[model samples]
Each structure stands twice: as structure tokens, then as C-alpha cells.
Target: MVALRGRVWDSGVMQNGALSELFGRMADVMEILAEDRFRVNTYRKVARIIADTPVDIGELLESGRLAEVPGIGKSSLAKIEQFVHTGRIEAHEALLRRIPAGLLELLRIPSMGPKSVKAVYEALGVTGMADLKAALESGAVAELPGFGRKKTDQLLKGIAFLEKATGRIRLDQAAEAAQIVGAFLAEIGQVKAIVPAGSLRRRCETIGDVDILVTVDEADVPRDEGRRTMDERRGAAGMGTGRMPVLRAGETLATHKGRTPSAQEAVIEAFTAAPFVDEVLASGPTKGSARIRTVEALVQVDVRVVAAGSFGAACQYFTGSKAHNVALRELAVKAGLKLNEYGLFDGEKPVAAAEEADIYKALGLDYIDPRLREDRGEIEAARNHTLPAPVSLKDIRGDLHMHTTASDGEDAIEEMAQAARRLGYRFICITDHSQSSAIANGLSARRLARQVKAIRTLNEKSRDLTILAGVELDILADGRLDFDDAVLADLDYVTASIHSGMAGDREKLTTRMLKAMDSRYVNCISHPTGRLINERGAMDLDMEQVVRHAARTHTALEVNANPWRLDLKDTHCRMAVEAGAMLAIGTDAHSAAGLTLMAYGVDTAARGWATKKDLLNGMTVRQLQVFVNKKR
Candidate 1:
């Protein structure tokens, strides 16, 4: 499918994400046109499959492993093959032609679905945001058959939110885009190294764009035997052996021999020419930039070709929080040195140009990790030689919250346990929703009792892992939990949350949360702020008070790992830990695949400078039991 912007790959190279996007875009367009519901759903499902597939589509196709995936029949296989070979889906192009391209933009509005967009289009001739805004302002949309005043107001609010939203995308989206673009660039035989720079390297929750620094193996015609060997391997593997025409060891590099592009130019060409790229923003001998299409978003990726000697310097300069860089430069100025993307120099005599640690050591400071380079007290700590080690995924001993088929989860309890065990987790808690959360197929008291027995029975049979019975009990607006304390007494863990009545004022919401924490059975709070990134704003709770109350009550606050809701966000995580409250990292996984989301939570915790001591996920099973038992 062709978007208004992005180039289709003519190189015949394809990634799973690109194929997923094509099918997803087709599904979206078909929905807008009110195409066959079954076909639309089928396309959407396949899109998800492609996006979630562990291997690249090209690799899968080459290995003939496509048939292993259920639901992909001959027609779907044909489309996948067609897109792989020709970079276009004929049916997708036909559907795009049937609708105004701007209609797709309308679907991006929060709460705006295809049906709503179709209604507005049919009734008020709304083709895009500008047209829709006019119709809403004139009360024409409110008067539509199904849209009343409330719906119109929501649409207007959504539009305002969309307008206010930053162009930056979530961290996962940027990372995925970087992987796809980086892979494409790596295909070039001359490309030697690719390192992600900027906010992406810093592990920020969102990224404005992707910046990558690269080094190409440059050599003269009597090419080094190693370079020749690599080229031979590339050719043997069916990848073309294309070499750049110039070579240099230091800063004075590129000397063009005829029209053949230099090594840097070749890399830039391949980068901007990738099929996943939507638009080429800029191209040069040393740098190239383009907006690339990933399954999740259209992300702009910039690539800079630098000498191997300057690669580290380039990384430090580009992988920056401007404030941190400014602080480092000030130190450089005071020390009679100069620092830039080229190198850290003492009066133009290169002092440190190689590794990041070398630059820090020359400046008389410890190397600050990219995650700690946010200019948030890390610089001072690094200088003082007191930087605390940040928490890592390996430190997580267990996932404290999850669900199973007894609730809304996709997998059975045993299956969920096996997935956690495979990750080397010592323990996991099955925190299914309480009865009040009817929409989630929440379990009743009797059901919970039965689940608790099933978990105990399972735990008895297992020696390597422990499964704890838990409930994500709802906190009513009036400050009572979905279940009484008597019901909670039967469970090994309890996480209280406000799922409904979140519209209450700050004082009211804060009071309800505090009251819930008062329960001895409550050991943690899940998705503490209830914020769905980009879609919903955080609930207005006085988090300062909540943190203090949690610390006092010994209730750990959760840093939910779900990308959409990294609730108890980085900032909140810092605040909570500073206030003496512990954090619990949980994928809040509904499916076995969801268990991997813990990486996002761990990164967020690290960004906040959390150590293993401040997170309950790092606690041993026995220690965790002691913790919850102490609450009782």
C-alpha cells in the first residue's frame, strides 16, 4: 500500500514490520470504506501476526516457514509474496483510491473510529481535520444521527489533544524504526558499525527522532584480505558485494575517483533508498535523513558517516540531553580543552577521540551511562564517584502482576507460569481483576477462592517456581474495595486500583486511593496513575500524598511495563523511590507474549535511577512473601 508519503522498496528487501504496515494500512482503508467485515478483520489479524513475528518476513519466506503461522492461507500468502517481490499490494492501492487520503488522518483522533469518520463524511462531507473541525464548530456534527453534544465535545477535545501532542513517538516505536533502518544500512557491504544516538540511546520514554552514527570499512584497490574475505562472504550469501571508491584513515578522508560515490556516500544512498523510508529529508556525503515507515509510526531516522576514530565522540555529542552536553563542555572549557562531535581536543591535539570512557577519564570524571545522562543530578554524582548502579532486567527476579484465562488473559494459568519460568523468574502473581471489573470478566469471590486453591495446588507440585494467588481489586469512588478484607485474606497478594470513577476531582481521588492503601491486604497498586500514553492523560491524583501514604502503608507502587501505560512513569518512579516507597515492575501481561514487556519497565526504572533495592521485582520469593505477610 502506498501512503501519501514513503517510497516502496525497489531493492526487493523487506522487513516484517513493513509488510505488517502494508496489511494494516489496507485494513484501515477498507474499514473506512465499509468493506467486508470478515476480510477487514482477517487483514487486521494478519497485520498483527506479521508485526509480532520473531523473524524477518524475508527470512521466513526464504525458509518456507510462512505456513507454520495459522490463519495465513493462499490468498494472504500471495499478497505477502507480491509485496515482497514488487513492493505494492494491488488491492490496497485500489482501496486507497476510493477514499480521500485525508480521511485516514481523521481515524488518528482519539475515540474516533472508522464508523464515526464514515458518519461525519457521509453527513457533513468532512474529509479531514480542517473540515471536521468546521463541522463540529458549526454544531453540524452534534446534529448527526448518532453524535450528540457529548460526542461532539469529546471529538473537539480529542482534536485539541492531538494538536497539542508532540511529534515525538513512544520509545518502543523509535527503537523498532531504528532496528529496521539500521538493518537496511547494514546490508551494504562497506558499512562497518551502526550505533543509535540521541534520546534513543538515553532510553527516554519518547523520542523526537532517531540518530545513528556509522563507520564504514574503507580500503584501497589492493583491499585488505579481511575486507576481501567479508565481501566474498556477502557474495556467497547472495548479498551483492559493492565497495566504496575511496579510503582514508583519519579526518582528511574522502578523495573521489570519478563518479563512483565515496564510502560515506554509498551508505547515505542505501539509507535513504530503503523501501521502508517514506521520504528522503536530506542526503549528503557524510549525513542522510529520511522518514521511515515502521509498523507503529512514521519515524524520521538520521544517519551520520564518521571515521572510526571519531565514532565515540560523535556518539557522546549526539547522544545528549543538551544540558548534560553543556555541563561537559563547561568542564572542558575550564580544563583548557575543547569537546565536539569530532573529538575531545587539547588545543587541536586530539586528547580523546576513541571510546566514551576515555573522554570521561580525560575530563577527570567517571563515565556516565546514557540512561543517567539526563542532567538530573547524574553529572554531580559521576564527578563525586558516587553514581549508583542502575537497575537492569537481570535484577528482576519475578513479575508481580499478570492474568490468566480465568479472567481476561489469553493463556491458562499453567501456561503463564511456564512462560515466567522460562524467563528465569522465581515467582509470579496471578492478579486477575475483581468482580467489580465486569467488563474484564472479573472473577467473583467464589471464583477467586477456587483460583487460590488451584494456585496452591500448582505451587505444591512445583519445586523451582512459586505462583501466588492475587486479585487486582477495584477501589470504588466511595473508598471501599471491590472485595471486603475477609475475601482478600484468602489471597497471597493484592493490588488495588481505581478503574472507574477516575473523573473524580484530585482531592476525592487521592482520598479514595489512600483509603484503599489503608487495607492491610493491599500490597501494591497497579498502573498507579492510570495513564495511557498519548491516548489518555493521567488521572488527577495528588501523587506526593499517594507516595507518602504508600511508604507508610508498605504498599509498593507498580511501574507497569505495558508500553501504552508505563504508569508510575519515570518521574513518578523517582518521586516514589525518593519518598521511601518501593516499586514493583510488572508486564501486567494478559498473554504469554506480553511477558516480555518487562524490559520497558526496567528501563523506566533505570531512567529514574532506581536500584534493585528500591524495586520489589528484585526480591526473592521468600522475601516477597515476608513483605506481604508483614503487611498483614
Candidate 2:
């Protein structure tokens, strides 16, 4: 009993992410050791289930709810209970002990699965990346069974891709790092404000490094006095908002550089000494760069201390797409002004130094959101006052896709509904998997009918929320949906998707996708491209044809909001919108915490120039019903 209490204390602090990773690593090690394939897949499945679960395992265990989840069998349950009580899975540790720890790193390379690694280890005695790379280059790996010229070539390419992608991190990972680091820096008394800049500010899908801009507290600095200061300074200088006297070509403007020399050192020192920081890359009076540790990876974060007057200018300059900044500077030059991080100026006189909007207005352009500063016709649109109003999180009235305990989800239908209601959603659809996905414990016809009845019962009781019974039906390899129209007609919404046979012929896959959309019962297609960022490339399919068919059928294409699978990416979203197809920003949330991922989907749509009207989720509950009903 004493050991149990001690174990529970340790387990309580282990977050879901850490637990997921632990199981995932265990599976990798098991595969490397040539463990039973069924056992390995079970471990992988449990890892996925845990990762999708937002709630703490200890809490679930305390409530005796963990055992209720499907896909977790007796043995798996034992392992989980062991983990919960002892904060360790001895089975996983035992598997890890059988192989060289470095062998796990080999799995990071694409196309290097456990079976392949096992073969290489046995044949070539390759246990690490360096040894494998040497073997591939020397053409020895090609001589191995099942690895010929073609596969070897792919492995070599994977190695090169891995090398190029090494230091870069995903946007979601960088955001988490920034949040933690920002919280850490906010503790410093000398710090006045913090703002994330660089590609992060622009919301790039992948970030090379993170840049943070801070305003140091100074004696003379005006806090939140940007507009007032701008008006006072411009009026006192006898300058009008209209065009200032044009400076001659090659004439430079003296910029008002705001650097509090007294406070810079203190802020920089505090930033470098942050707890999350792994190594101090560079430190100075105004700038400090460090590699900060995160649950995902070690990311380089550069913090810059700037004066209040130049804060807006610094934000505009550093939160840049290099091409967009270059184009903006060209426009500034044409207007007889000098633009830089310090501020926008006209021949030694500061014009718009305190506000980004003022800087754009002075340049005769509308304010461009940072997300649209990719030089992808946004500047031209701003000049013409024709930029589309991008979709916002508030515009999402409902979530059209999600799972429940009826399938492989960690939460119950009512649980998901309550969570969505808390997020101010007017409606939500319960989209458990159809009967084809045995692995997910997909509902049978009888089970689905019962769930439909249950949803209707819940809908009657839900005064402010509309609950739609839906099924994420599988599109079989032969281009037929897993459930017939008879089974699908009972549901309020249906999301069709390809879960297998993605490696088929391009023409066939395209045909399969088009056929799925033609069904009157199909309301949308989820993760149309079927991709997992950084892990799997998109399946081969004629997307143009898919989009065209979707538009003709009025089928909404989902912008699946899972960070790992932000499918129907920005470019694809734009293409689909241009083709006249609507988008559905579904969190594909397996758990309640997954519901918050709607923001990432919204961000992706905004980046694609999607307006609120372009999204199905952006519609009122009644409007959404009309849309899906029309398809039926």
C-alpha cells in the first residue's frame, strides 16, 4: 500500500504526452528486437490512443474509466495499470535492454521500419545511422535481400532529406516553446513586454528558429503610448499625415533607434539564464540566443530587447517573409522614405514609428495581417483594398467531425458534446468510424442504429446545442464506401475518407476519391490528401480532379485540424476554394483536448485566403443542416 501511494504520486505528474512517447519508444525498441508483430501493433495502437487522450491517465484510472476504453485488452490493461501504479512499464524496459539504444535512432529515417532495421542489423551489423549511411553509400545495403537498387536509392534519398530537415521544428512545437519561454521571461522585472516575431509571427508550417522581441522597462519609455506618442511627435514636428517632402535618391533618413543601454544587459542576462535553455548560443546587451529544451526537441530561441518607440517597427521588420519585406522596402523607396527596424522615416524625420497600421497607411496600403505577408499577392491585394477577410476561430459555429468511445476515442459521446458546448459551439457531430475499421472497433449496423437513436435522445435534451449523428465511413479500395446508402442515410452527416490502399495507382486512387464524393450520402471528405507532416508524404492522387468533383457534388472537403495531419494544407485549401468547394475545419478530435486544435485549422485556412463563407463550420447550425441535407 505504501509503494502504491508512492507510485501514484510519480504517475500523477507524468503527462499524457510523455506517456504516449514512452509507449511509442517501447514499440520501436520491440520492433527492433523482432518482437511479435501483433504485440508490436497493439503497443502502437495504445500509444496512439493515449496520445489522443487529453485527460490524465491517473485521473481516468481513479475513476475506473480506463478499462472501459476499447482496443485495450487484458494484457494491455495490465501493462497500463502497472505503469499507473509503478510509473514504469518493466516490459518496455526489458525490450529496450535487448538492443543498442542507438538502433532506435535508425527509425527516424523514412522507409526505415523495424523490419528493415532488423534485417540490416542482422545482415550488415548496422546498429546506428552512421553505419547505415556508410553501408548505403558503399552499396553494401543494396546487396541485402529485399533491398535492391530501387529501395536502396530511396533510402539514400531519405538520408539526404533527414539531414536537410534536422534543425527545423514544426510550428506547433515552436509555439509551445515560445509560450513557455515567454512565461519564464515575464518573471523578469526589467522586461516591459514580449512579442514573438520571425516566421512564427507569420505562422509558417515549419520554423527554422524562434525569435522573440521584448521591450525593456526604461525610465523615459512610454508604456502603451504608441498612438499618443505618434500624434504628439508628428504634430510637434509640424508634419502632416500626407506625403512628406521627397528625399533625393541615395539620401538616407536618420532613424530613431530605441535601445535602453541600461536595461538591455539585465533583460538579456535573465533571458539567457532561463530554465528551459539548454545552451547559450550567444549573449549580448540587446540580444540573447539560446537552444531551449522542449518536450519535442531542443529549439534555438533568440530574444531581442528593443526600446518602446521602435517596438512596432521591430515587429514589422522581423516578423517578415523576406520577399514581402524586400517588396515593402521597394515601395518605401518609391515613396521617398526609408524603412527599417527602427521606423519608417522621410529624410531624417520620423513619420510612422509607433504603429504598424500607421506605417502601412502612410505607404498608401491597407494593414496586412502577418499571416498573409508571404508575398503571395497579399501586398497587391492590400494596395487595391481587395484582400479577403480571413476566417477566425469565432466564425466556427460547429465541429463537423470527431470520435467517441463507440469507436476508438477515449471519451464518450456525451463527454465530447459537453466539451464542445464549453467551447461555445452551437453544434457538434459524433463521427465514429464505420463498420470497416475493425481495428478501431467500428460500429456494426445494429450498433450504429442504436447510437443514432441515442444521439437523437441527446439532441432533444440539448437546448442550446444540436447533436448530429455522423459516421466517418471508409472508402474501400474498390471505390465503394464501407457502408451502403441504406446504412448511411440514417445519419445526419457522413465523412468519406481513404484509410487504406493509398499506395494504389494514381488514376485508381483519384477514381476512388471521385466515386466517393459522387454518393449523395457523403457530405464531406476528411484529410483529402491523407498526409502526416514530416512522417509521410501525401498519397498520389489527382487533386485537381478531386476538387472539381467536390465542387460539382457540393461536397465539403475537411481541413483536418490535427496538428500532425493538417491535411488540405494552405495551398490545397486555396485551390479548393477557387474551385468553389466548401471547407470543414474538423479537429478530428479523438478527445476533448483535441477540440482546441480547431485554431490550427483556422490558421491554415486564413493562410490559404479562405473567408468565413468558404467554410461549412463557419455556418449557422441551420445553414449547416441545409448544406448536408441538400447533398442528401
Candidate 3:
């Protein structure tokens, strides 16, 4: 109901993530209490179901259909209802009263499960990590059932590894992971749809976790159907097209159908045991949870499957910004209708249950793009029918910031250019690193001069492709440009960036970037905040001021599409657009094979709610040059 577009409101994807954690905690507490295995299994099943669900549990309960959902029953439903209404579960509180809350920390260690912990607590009086460590050191836990010296050593190592993964991962990391897992599940004969949900779907810059939703054909039950494959359409539509193996439509799955097996169970079994998965946290027919080992870190992944009738409802519910869904739920309430993952209903009479578009239509708002579901004003825009039609991967005319063997790039300039041409690009800029980045084989002034000459030399012979001389100029800690203006004047594009000093003072960092942007030689700022997904934190710079200055100076802010650094973050891109600044989407590629990665940045820009009008690369070759010149 807000009038301003993209209005800011503190929000989240509350229920699925929050409840999942709660249930996981409950499971731990039950195990610590050393309760019967059956009671613990019951809560674990509920957690799995809640984690996989697309909609809020409260919504399902409020609609009086909580018990009808698969895996939900009278006992579990009562606990969920009690927890939702009272903010505390009596059983959980009672357990907490008996056990030291600190003991719960033991479960987070990969090697420590409830039974293992229960045995230790009863044998050694160990209740927390500190006690557990002391017991391990004193040979106190070695003789406990299922506890061995080797296992103790592994737990010690696992504890240290767990501590390192405490913060957020770069959104691209989560997206890439989902892409890998989603692509893998797409070939499962029983899985009808595979869609990523949660913060990854909302396209947040940093992701806390990942969730993927699927529609399973219960009757087929994963029979290795020859028809289910990653056709060209799926390859293009799904994630990591270039990175993972695609399952062709006609390929055989090595296994045949089991006798009357449940489709959901079959898919979950395949997913939990996928080669990319490191560990299975929870597994059931309806939902699966696992840890995926990426080159960066072990990331948590969740998969939820819904029946076909509730597929659209599940998609919308799971792909949520808690604030956005809450807004929609409020809207539905005003219209005298109830909305849940099952579908929209008016007093139990079905309204829209099939397509997401129809659900939005039934709610009287034009379909709001998932990227705009941050409650930043998309709802009001949808009401006004003025929602932005964001720039798509197809709208890109060129990739402007890339490298070549002239610097650290794996491919030569000519090879990168040829790859761009094959992608039907009108222009490509050779933005190899300049003098300061020695590790990247940075180019010296003389080397840059030679590279520029070669680029112009190649452009003359090319018919469909236009090559632009560019430099990824380094900005020092003291706010000085690596290449002189004399060098920049001759180049078609210059991307100024901070390679080091990311951990310096915030005000100083902002000033340093502002100084770089003030230079007429700078066309864009690459990976404005030099964050490596999950590995490091963002630099302490004032992005609002930097974006405003870019708007004023006509310098473009780059969305570096390295999958590791989708910098400028979608929010910053939105801020840039709000300040009338233009954006450039670049793969910041170091090789020819990196061209396909532009889709990641395009996806990020769309999340920022940017359109073709907001992008500099959307311009034709001649037009791009004019824009460059105009900035100059």
C-alpha cells in the first residue's frame, strides 16, 4: 500500500528459514535430553517438511488446513500451532529447563549427533563445547559408546571448520550451487519442476542459505523415464548451463523403476546422495537437506517437492521476501480471500491454483517479478501497473570489462573477441589489468600501448564485431590512479577499481573511490566493493555517496559477473538507478569461456529492478561509443 516504488522496509523470508532452524534446534534438544528415537524422528520430519515448504506455516495453520499438508499430523500440528501462537513450545521449554542450553552447541559439530552426545553427557558430565573439549583432552570421552580417538580428532577439526562458515556467502555462490543441484535434479524422472527459492531467488547480494523447490509426479515415482532430460529449453532456462553435465531428453538413468516406490522419496534419495553433496542433514520423501562443497565453502541446500496441484502456490510461497509475502497476505485479507502455498481460496472455494501469474491476477495485481519481491514498492507498482520490465540477458549488446593474455586473462584478446562475436555481441572491451596488479600479470604503460594498438588493428578487419581499447586501472590505497590521464585519454573505456586496501577505514575507502570516480578518464568502477563470495567481507565504503557521485559524474557502476563478485550488489544498482546513474554489466572475465557468465550479472541487475534504459551496455556499438564520449 506504499506509494513510492521500492520503498524500504526491514524484511526477510521468515517462516521457511526461521522454522527450519527452530525445528532443527528442537531436534537437537530432544537428542540432548536423550529422549526416545521416535520422538526425535517426529520433530526431524516436521523440520524437513517446514524447511521444504514454500509458504509460511502460520498461513497454513490459519487457513485451517495445516493437518492436511503432507507429513503434518495431530501431534506435530499441535506443536507447530503452539509454537506459532505462543512463540514457545512447552516441550522445548521443558527440555531447556533440564539441559544446559550451552549443550546445544555440541550438535552443530559435524561429528556430534544426539546419541553420541547423550552417551558423552551421561558418562563424562560434559554439557557444552568447552566441556567436550576438556573431556577429549583428558581421555574422558574416548570410552563413551560410539566415541573413538579418531572420531574425536575429526570432531575437533569439524568444529574449527564450522566456525569459519559463520557469515553470509556471496549470492552468486548460492546461485551457482542451486544451479548445479537444480540441473542435477531436473533429470529425475519424477521431478516435474526445479525452481530455486528463498534469498537466492530474491537475488540478495549475500545469501544465508539456499532452497530449491520441485514438483514431483507422485504416481511415476522416479522410474528413470527416458523422456525426462535437460533439453535445450531446460539447459537455457536452468542454472549453470556451461558448468554442469546436461541430461539429454533421451538419455537413460542407469536405474529402472522400483516396485510402487514413492516419487518424492526417489527424488530425495537421488538428491541427498548426489556427488556434489558433502553431507545429508535431513532426508524424507517430501523434503531433503544437504551440505554442498563448493570451491569456496560447504553451503547448506534445501529441496522441497509439492504435488502438481499446489506447484504454483509452493513456488510463490517459497520464493519469498517475508515482507513481500506478508504484504500480499495482507492484501488478500483485505480482499476477503486466503492465500497459502496450496492456492488462493475464498472460504475453501478454490480461486487460482495452477499458475503464479493467475494467482497474482486473481489478487488484482499484475504479476510482480520474483526479483522485485523485496517489498521495496513492487506491490504498489503492481497495483499501478507500472512495474519495471527489467533488462534481460537477451538485451545485452556487449560485455565491456574483460581481460586477455595481455594481463592475467587465460585467453588472448583475439580469442575473447571471437567468443563475444559468437554470442552475437556488437562490441567487447579489452579491460586487462594495468600496472599495479602484478599478480594478475598487470600491463605496464608500454604494454598497454601495444595492446591498444593491437585492438584497433583487429577492429579494422572485423565485420560484425567492434573492439574497444580498455584498461582496468588500479586505484591505490591513497586514491591515486595507476595509469596516467595521458594513457586514459587514448582508451575507449577505463574501469577504475580498488584491488587492495579493502579493509581500510570506511571514510578513507569512500574518499578513495570518490577520487577515482572524479577522474574524467574513468568510465566505470569495477567490482566497486572487492568482495569474494563467502571468503571475505565487503569493503567499508559509503555506496550511497559513491552512487550519487557516479550519477553526477556520468560514470557507470559495474556489476561484475564473476560469480564470485556480483558487486555493486542489486541494492546498490537500484540506488545507482535511483540517483540517475547508469550501470554496466560485465563478466570481468579472465577467459573466453567466461562469456556465458554475463547471465549472472544480468540476473542481478534485474533484481535491482533495472531495465534496458538503466544499462550502458544495452546501447548499440555506435551508441555505446557515443555514451562513452558523452561521459568523457
Candidate 4:
């Protein structure tokens, strides 16, 4: 099947989440109908497993590994298989056939479950949310034996809370919220380390909620050990002094084989009452949940406190794309050890947990970066010690695509060069727009030539930077370059791109890009797919064919660093690398300020699993010149 840019892969994740919901519904229905308790519990447990798993169930079944997966037995397997093949599970269908679908939805209400749902349904015929609200208003639900006025009022509050929390936010929005919350908590001296977890940590495109893991150093909390009374000492050699002056109230959530009140508890308490927090779902010493309201959205943030010793284990556990962690746990099992958030255990002895690398090392695997923790063959790669050490933001030597005042860019060429030099870059390409890009103040052949001479003069004056004369040539609808070859040939680098004709016919689009890639004057293709995230959807092209053609030619592909246009995304980066094609990460900077966006491109490249070996910007100026000069 032809893979779609925003389809199957993302849809698979959603499918898994939906299955979790569906399975839980099945369990709730069976329980209410008074089905077998064992089967009900089995379904409930499996729902959690399915929900946590990163890979799609259908994909697992296709691989014939469904049977071997934990929490999936013959009965559950049949249900899943039936759902995959026929689009519906008979067991689920049977249960739905018996109960009003509305009652199952009622279980979604805060603190409401099978017993309460059954009671409400029987007493007031309140089968759905609307019915339940009506019953409450009529005083019918309040009259139920176990549910008093307070419970009814709370349920109303829960309904409103659930409604607000129902829809998910985009990954970018969640990221902003997490950063704000993290910065706020970092002020507290007790917080040793704080990092994002859940889908946000995994860098999933869309996030259900943001989970943050906080490690509290014991030294940060106050301890009162000096002169405990005899009776007080007798109560316990006791936990460490959990002196937290940060919050109004703090309590221990949980503790492992360590001593002292968990430092994690204080963090939980402070986080719950943090100024940004809008609601606290669950709060304890080890883990805290709250909704942090950013200017644009309310994002749920989970803070898990960990001791110093188990820091690595807990980080790995909570930073999970569950599918990735499940793979790691299986590896631990095979090695005759158990891995959990607390630490990896060899029977009664603790093995590795102090550091994330140590935990992976103990498993005989290389440390897998959190971004690559999607169980997409990363485990096998790690086992063989072949995991790609992706190119970091620091490794970038220069940018290849940028514009200046000659185009519609805000900065002058000299100013842009100064900005790049300040970034310690060895070189930069002034890729101003060509004649066809009138909207961007496209430079004519005369203007471009003047710009080139000015750059050459700047190069002579500059001690630390080399400026390359370049043009971002637009490929016309008919596969013709904006400027003739004579003009392109004069430039040090020629980067072709699609600004118009983005929605052209598929085959024509692929051909148009291929024709540009085939040009001797073109050193690279910019933002190969022409996607403007959250604005313009990616264009249609046979990416496989395009990537193959790029490899055949020596032309590199540009991973546009602009957050708005992170084209040649993580998958394409990997595709280019595996095909032995070089890649360039360019900020596509229009102004000096846009140069900082290089990190965003690097992040996208990391997600694609691209390493220095796969990128052109990782090269020194001389080395990069050799590759850029190839098409000529």
C-alpha cells in the first residue's frame, strides 16, 4: 500500500487508543450485565495493555506475533483478530446489543463505574449523559440509596471536567505548555531534573496530554535528624526529613527500598498548587497530575518523582511510547531480570537503574534516544549496537538555504552573514528567490549578480565566514527553471523548490520535482514535499521514486528548518540516509531571527533517525563544497 503522509502511521496510534477505549467499554458492559468476573478482569487488564502499546494491533497480527504478546490469550486474541478482519468484534457487539450505548458512556463520568451506572440506570432510567443530567435535575438520581446530593453535585462537576478534557491538543501546543510548566518548576531548588514524557516525549505529532517526570534530590529537601525524641525515633529509623517549604501542603505518594520521605512528594504537592495548574486529577508523593493552562490551551501534565538511584529506570519507564518500553521489558525478561519504574532487579539484587544508559547497557543494547522510542525496529538496532547517533544541533556547520534583502527577506546580506558568523558557522548560502518569485521580491539576473559580487567582497573582508552565492530557483509548472541555466551556473549553489503548483497532478508533480533534481545547476531541492504544517498539507508525490532519483543524482535534499515548513520530515530523512543520499538542514531563514530555527530542523531530523553521516550540514566547509560541487 502507498503510505500517506498523515495517514496509517498516525492512524495506527489513534486506533490503538480507540481499541483501549473499546475494550474498556466491553469490560464495563460485561461487568454490569453480571458476566464472568474473571473474563471481565482479563478484558480490563488487556485494555490497559492495548492502550499502552505503541504499535498497531493489526500490524502485530500481520506479523504473526499477536499470540506471543503478553496479556493476549486465545479468547482476547480471537476478539482482536475478529475486529481486525471484520471491522467489529462479536463479543463487543453482543454486549453493545444488550445494553444502551449511553450507559457505557456514563462510565466516562468522573468516579462513576459499573455499580453506579447500573444503579442510576435502574432507578432513574438514566441511560446517557443527557438522561443522567435530567434525572439529577428531577431529584431522581439524588434519591438513589448510595448517591447523596454531594455525590450528585460532584458528578455534575465531573461531567463538566470530562467535557473539557475530552479533546486532545496539537503537539506544538502541548510542547509550549510543557515548557512553561517546566520553567516554573525549575525555580524550585528541590527539582533535580525535569523532562517531558508520554507522547510529547516521544515527539508524536499529536498529543493526548503532556507527562513530565521530575527527579527530586534528597539534599534539596530538609531533614530533621539531629535530636528526635526517643518515642519519635522508635516509630521508625524513619524516612528522610521531607522538609518542603515550597508548597502549602505536601505528602508522600509512594516509596521503594530507599529511606526517607520521598523527595518526589514535595514536588507533587507544589506542582498541584502551581499558579498555572487549573485542575489536579491525582496527586501523590511519587506521581502528580494536573492541567496547566497555557495562553492557547489547557494541557494535562503528569509529574512522577523518582529517587536518585532509580532515576534512569523511572525516566525510561515514564518517557515511554509504551510499545518501546514493552520491547525493552521483554529484553530484560530474556536476560533473567525484571525491569520496572523503580529499577531493574536481578532477583533480590538491583542491577542497573542509576542511569538510562546503564539500564540499556545492562540489557546489552545501546541507549536509544527517546525520540526513536516508537518500537519501529529501534530495539533490534540497539541490540546490535548499530543505533544511529543522530546529528545534534551543535554539529551543524552552516546553513544552505536562506534569503536576504535582495529577496523579500528582512535582513541585508552582510547582516545575515554577521548573524551566521555569530552562530560560529563556517559558511552560509544566501539563497534569495529567483525572478519567478515576484511575491518574495525575486531578484533579477542583474540584481542577483550584484548580490554575488557584494558577497564575494564580504568574503574577502570577513575572517571567519565563507558566503556562498545561491538562488532558491522556483520550478515552474512545466518543469522549467525560473532563471535560465546561464544565471544558475554563475551561483555557488542552486536550490530548486515548489512554491506554486503544489497541488498539481501527482505523476506530474513527481516528474516536475524529478526534472528539477536532474538539473546539473541544482545542488539541492528545498522542502521536497512542499508542506506547511497545520497550514498546507503536503503535496502528492511518489516519495520513494523521488528519493531514489535523488540518490541516483548527487543532488542533496533539504530538511527545511523553518517550523512552519519542516519538510523532508523524520521519515524522509531516514529514507534519504538509507538510500545513501546526503541531506541538508536549512533554516530557510528570511530574517536573522529565523536562524535560531535550526534546532527545529535538527529535531525533525532526529525524529527521522538521521545521523551526521546522512547530512551535508555536518561537513566542514571544504568537505561540503566537494559534495555541493558534484552536479556541476
Candidate with top TM-score is: 1
Q: Candidate 3: RMSD over Cα atoms?
A: 17.6
RMSD of each: 6.1, 12.4, 17.6, 20.9
Clashing pairs in 3: 6-376, 7-376, 12-322, 54-317, 54-318, 221-263
Candidate 1 stretches with Cα past 4 Å from truth are: 1-25, 47-62, 78-97, 143-146, 220-258
The per-prediction tally of clashing pairs is 1, 0, 6, 5
Q: Which stretches of model 3 miss by more than 4 angstroms?
A: 1-168, 218-259, 273-278, 292-296
lDDT-better candidate, 1 vs 2: 1
Question: Against the hidden true structure, what lDDT does model 3 obtain?
Answer: 0.77
Q: Which ranges of candidate 2 are over 4 A from the true structure?
A: 1-127, 130-167, 220-261
- Among all windows of 10 consecutive residues in model 1, the one with the lowest summed lDDT is 1-10
Worst 10 residues of 2 by lDDT: 1-10
Listed in order, each prediction's TM-score against the native is 0.87, 0.75, 0.67, 0.66
Best by lDDT: 1
What is candidate 3's lDDT per residue for 523-587, written digit by digit as tens?
A: 89999988765444589888889999998988999999876778878888889888999999999
Residues forming the 10-long window of minimal summed lDDT in candidate 4: 5-14
Model 4: residues with Cα > 4 Å off, grouped in runs: 1-172, 203-206, 223-263, 278-281
User: Model 3 Cα displacement at 500 (Å)?
Assistant: 3.0
Q: In angstroms, how far off is 108's CA in candidate 3?
A: 21
On lDDT, the stronger of 2 and 4 is 2
